[model samples]
Target: MKHIDVKEIISSKEFIGQEITICGWVRTSRNSKSVAFVEVNDGTSLKNVQVVVEKGESDYKEPRVGMALKVTGTVVEGRNNTVEINAVPEGITVLGDAPTDYPLQKKGHTLEFLRTIPHLRGRTNTFNAVWRVRSVLAAAIHEYFQTHNYVYVNTPLITGSDCEGAGEMFQVTTIGYSNDYKNEEDYYTNDFFGRKAGLSVSGQLEGEMAATAMGKIYTFGPSFRAENSNTPKHLAEFWHVEPEVAFAELNDVIEIAEDMLKHVIRTLLDKCPDEVAFFDAHFEKGLRARLEELISHDFGRVTYTEAIELLKNSGENFVYPVEWGCDLQTEHERYLSEKVFKKAVFVTDYPKEIKSFYMKQNPDGKTVAAVDLLVPGVGEIIGGSEREADYDKLIAAMNERNMNLDLYSDYLDLRKFGTVPHGGFGLGFERLIMYTTGMANIRDVILFPRTVGSIR
Candidate 1:
């Protein structure tokens, strides 16, 4: 007997009256005198297949909730044109048994409680919906880039350079420290890779090198950070979707970012309507409407200087001071997107000191062409900059910050030999999923989320 999926049986009505074998875990089971009704799910879809097992039909005892089962049955039409299975006596097998202490039962579970058991949470309806949506979102990201002729490059996981220049990075080391150990700094000279290396925080630098040769390229991979923030918005390890384009400026990067966001949202709405509907009903009311508005309306665009002016005159008491050079806080970004624009907005031309050294310097030598895209609920989902293609200015920016020139010689070489006007942006993949699914915390979207004081 050929095995059939629950989704196939539920979605295809032609399978009615056909004999089939199905394998799934019991979601809920109830036994009557004549027959036993079991709701079985195979993780193929949110809906489960209803199986009717008559008395003396199976060799084993009554199946309990969470028991893995395989049964041979005949499919018949249920009420409202749905299809169900009628299990035969000789074809039922209990693949695994669930003990009485099984954590997940037939009751509602709190999200906080689910976090404790990350391994088994995926079986629940809420997490099943979340992970399915996450899978679709990931596929949509690759589709958007691939259809645009962007070569997918797998960037290195370990690197010796810091792309963001922020010192908050996790270091990779193999040397053990002890009282007898000497020359602690020099020990790295003989360690793995022959020099200091750490997990990559962003693939932008390498992605740019490939883009200069391939015209357009993207990287979808995991990046690590060592920040100690325990907020719902931060994660120690997460995925990033970074795309680089050759000969593109700030405006060009902004257009690409906007288009990509819309494409992913549209794909999610079309592909996973059931999953998206679940989030819309429970997590955030009017989520579908908000997504519809975002794709239809033009994203608001403003400069960092103008944003500071607007905030200063609005008479809103902000905890962080609104200044031209100061970095925009989460509160500021939310205000711009939620209160002022009421949609996604791009704030560009940030102060050079506040941004990375690679951003192109404006003619005034004060601000760089750095841009951040802030959405209605999440602040700053995408960040990009028109790079400093001019080799001299690039070197000067590096020098002002006292960056180690030796470590980034290869990156500097990109500007030296046949460099063009290029730009790119990094999108937080987990945060994007949060926005699409209306998931409040970044940890809830990622599987086995790594945060402060939590490794598993």
Candidate 2:
């Protein structure tokens, strides 16, 4: 049995009249007086290969719409299509019988319903597009780094420090529940290690070391956040693309991040035109045009001070009133990106009070050289700032924030070891995918979105 993948059939025109064996899951079935047609897919591509089944007192029964089958048939051109592999199947063997309760059916189903069955959602066209586009984006990220002489590094997922300083963390525990519970007073700890351990929030701290030594390095992996926000953007566990560069300031980091995004957008638009067309028509009405505009236009750069001033002057009703001391809300971010900038913009130099401790303090003693890259539809796709290279100031800031400086001793030593002014920002991978694919929710972009209520 010679097997040719359906995807190969896309370019292999000579196999039209040849007998070939195709093994795939049945997508849909249609029966006529003397023949039945079944559309099948083998994860080769989105388009299902059509199989013709004729009832000629043949022993092999027609396969079900969701059943797995191996069919030996001859390809022939059929009606209303080109490259038709019309098959009068000589043998049809069932590989796996699907239960009637299979969530994915021929009939159209809602994305909300598909969320309940993450195991089978990839069979749908939308998810296939989303997942494939995500893969393409990841590849583009790696390619962009390689071209720029940035070394790819994998950082550990389990750690003892919180990079963001946000009070959201999930503990990394052992399989055993052997914790000494004395009146539930002590924190849970397994006998595996004496001290408490938890999942890493961001891989930035580790990547910083690699970058310090290697000059340029990027950490791309899963980052866990126990944030309970039920918004479309928040996810419990998501992927982060953090690139740390030595001797680079906030402005350079912002430029690199912007360039990286434009690179990815252009790559996706060029590499996956069919998928882009699909998304542009359905999810993002003018996605292709928006991406083209981004690649060509210079991003708007404004200080956080300026962004706040714009918000104040816009006369827009913001639920969270914008002020220098307060953090920017999603609404405020959207207003700036969507209305004020009208394109991807960088809001830089935020108040030190609202930012992380390690951010480099400006000469004014108020704002740090932090910048967030915000796009038209999505707000705050990237957040980064220059590091405080002054040892005294770094230690003082950490102490002021009441953080355990002892844990960040290595990080402090970088400043002590004659460190230059450096900066890096984290690009949320799912969020980036949302921006590129015109996906509205972060949930749909991720394969199995770990949210507040979902671990499945």
Report the Cα RMSD per candidate. 1.6, 2.4
Candidate with maximal TM-score: 1
Q: Which pairs of residues collide in model 1?
A: none
lDDT top scorer: 1
Q: lDDT score, residue 386, model 1?
A: 95
Query: Candidate 2, residues 1-456: lDDT per residue as tens digits?
Result: 467787776546677778778888988878877888888887766677887777776654666667988878777765556455555546677889987777776567877888888888888778878888989999999999999999999998988788877768887756445445653225444334544567889888888888889999998999998887888888988999999999998879988988898898899988888788888988889998988988898899999888888999998989888777789987888898889878888999999988988889999998888988888777788999888889999888888889987778888888767688778989999988888888888888888888887788
lDDT of 1 by residue, 415-440 (tens): 88999999999999999989988999
lDDT of 2 at 30: 81
Cα-based lDDT at residue 422, candidate 2: 79
